[model samples]
Target: MKIPIRSECLPYALILSFLSIIFYFLNKYIAILMLILLAFVLFFFRDPERTIPFDEKSFLSPADGKVIDICEIEENEFFKSKAIKVSIFLSLFNIHVNRSPISGKVTYKKYRPGKYLPAFKSHASEINEKNIIGIENEYTKVLVSQITGFVARRIVCWSKIGDTLKQGERFGLIKFGSCTEIIMPIDTEIKVKIGDTVKGGLTVIGVIK
Candidate 1:
């Protein structure tokens, strides 16, 4: 059986290959090292997984990885007040696609250019290059943040200012590996924890309202 790696590094691959040919005439060892690093980058950004199934009751995971944080964090955006935050960290080996956790309309969408930090760090959520999508449901508004990790340089988001989305829909893809955070209202109860492993679209991280 053949396994597939869903990474968008074809451009980098071509660029590296071209540079390798030029560097080969100057130094064979340096050229070989560059080739290896390029290969590692391509493999690290691999994306392999199915889209999370749609279910209103189940709050799906945004990225494929382990749940690192499921606590209350001070929300700065839509819910200017306090909120329960469920954070998922995606390593280089995990799938990089981001999916919607619930069905709702996007009330706010903003991309901030920031420094690239390790996804596992708590402060990285606020300082890393990220895309924030605020959604509103019948109960309350929820915000999903896609934070870029050290190696994951590109953050892709498909949500618009006034678009309606269904639960588990593919709204974005975090290039390479990163972290995803779901912020719920202060009154919302969190279901997952700091060390629990969660699968996107299947795990119930929290309930509505």
Candidate 2:
């Protein structure tokens, strides 16, 4: 199969490859190192297709990574009600592409500036820079947040308020390793737990009741 890379990464890959070529004429060892780095960057932006769940009540994962946290917290920013937050921490090796958890219209979108902490930490959810998206249909409202980790500084989000998104459709990507969170209704059933591995748009994270 062809390498499934994101178009957003082409500029980055090109610049790095050019540098790698120039360095190759000067020092073979340094050029090899640059090539390796280029490979990693290419891998980081890979966007593979996933089979989305068809269940009307199922809420798919918004990102690919290990579940770092699962808890019930007060969501004052958007829902203004209690919600079950599921945080997924993406490692460098995991796909950084983000997808919609369900088919709906984006009702809310916001970007916050803050400190860059390790995403695996619980505190990072509150202090780190992030982008929050709220999607809603006639059925329900769900919120998903894209958080930047210590190594991830750029968060790209294509979703905007009033835009429609299909379940498991690619919406954006975070550069390098980071975290993404899904806030579902507390009454929804939680399928995964802390430390569980999940694939974005593929894993059924919760069920709508």
Candidate 3:
């Protein structure tokens, strides 16, 4: 069976595999190291299929990770009002692909270049290099931020403004370890809490109330 890897892995996989072959003739240790790295690259970019729940009233988690923080904050980017922000921290072992939390039209997309800090830090959400995507439907609007961590330097987003997406649809991914935050209206009923493990496109983050 073909491995379910993201298209983004092609470049990395090819480069690493080529280097491994070239170095094998010169140094076995170096070639073995390259092979190990190649395996990790393939593993990290794996995009397994998910069973998306068909629920119009619930919003799914945007990425796979642990919920690090959740708080009410003044959101001026999309909601322009009080919003509840749920932050998820992706470790090296977690899947980095981001998914649409709700079935909606992509209304807003912005990329801000900034510092690469540790994603677990509370302040990292404000200063880290990030891509912000807003999706809205007839019921409500939601914002997902893909933030780059110290080791995660690239944030990939395939979604564009005006694009329509279904709940749990793959929108983009963050290379390596990073952070993802979902900001919803204050009235949203949150379903998960801090330290809760969530799977992208599978775990419900909130319910529209």
Model 3 scores a C-alpha lDDT of 0.95
* Residue 66 lDDT, candidate 1, scale 0-100: 89
As for lDDT, the candidate ahead, 1 or 3, is 3
Residue lDDT tens for model 3, 1-209? 56588989999999999999999999999999999999999999999987898788998999999999999999986888999999999999999999999999999999999999999998998899999999999999899999999999999999999999999999999999999999998999999999999999999999999
Residue pairs in collision within model 1: none
Scored by Cα lDDT, where does model 2 land?
0.90
Query: Cα deviation of 49 in candidate 3 (Å)?
Result: 0.7
TM-score of each: 0.80, 0.97, 0.98
In candidate 1, which residue ranges exceed 4 Å CA deviation? 1-7, 16-51
Per-model lDDT: 0.79, 0.90, 0.95
Model 3: ten consecutive residues of lowest lDDT: 1-10
Instruction: Please list the residue runs of candidate 2 whose C-alpha ends up more than 4 Å from where it truly belongs after superposition.
Output: none
Model 2 lDDT tens row, 1-209 = 77688888888889889989999999989999989998888888888766687666889999999998899999897789999999999999999999999999998999999889998888998899999999998888899999999999999998788999999988888898899999999899999989999999999999998
> Root-mean-square deviation of each candidate, in angstroms?
3.0, 1.0, 1.0
Q: Model 3: what TM-score?
A: 0.98
Cα displacement (angstroms), candidate 2, residue 10, comes to: 1.9
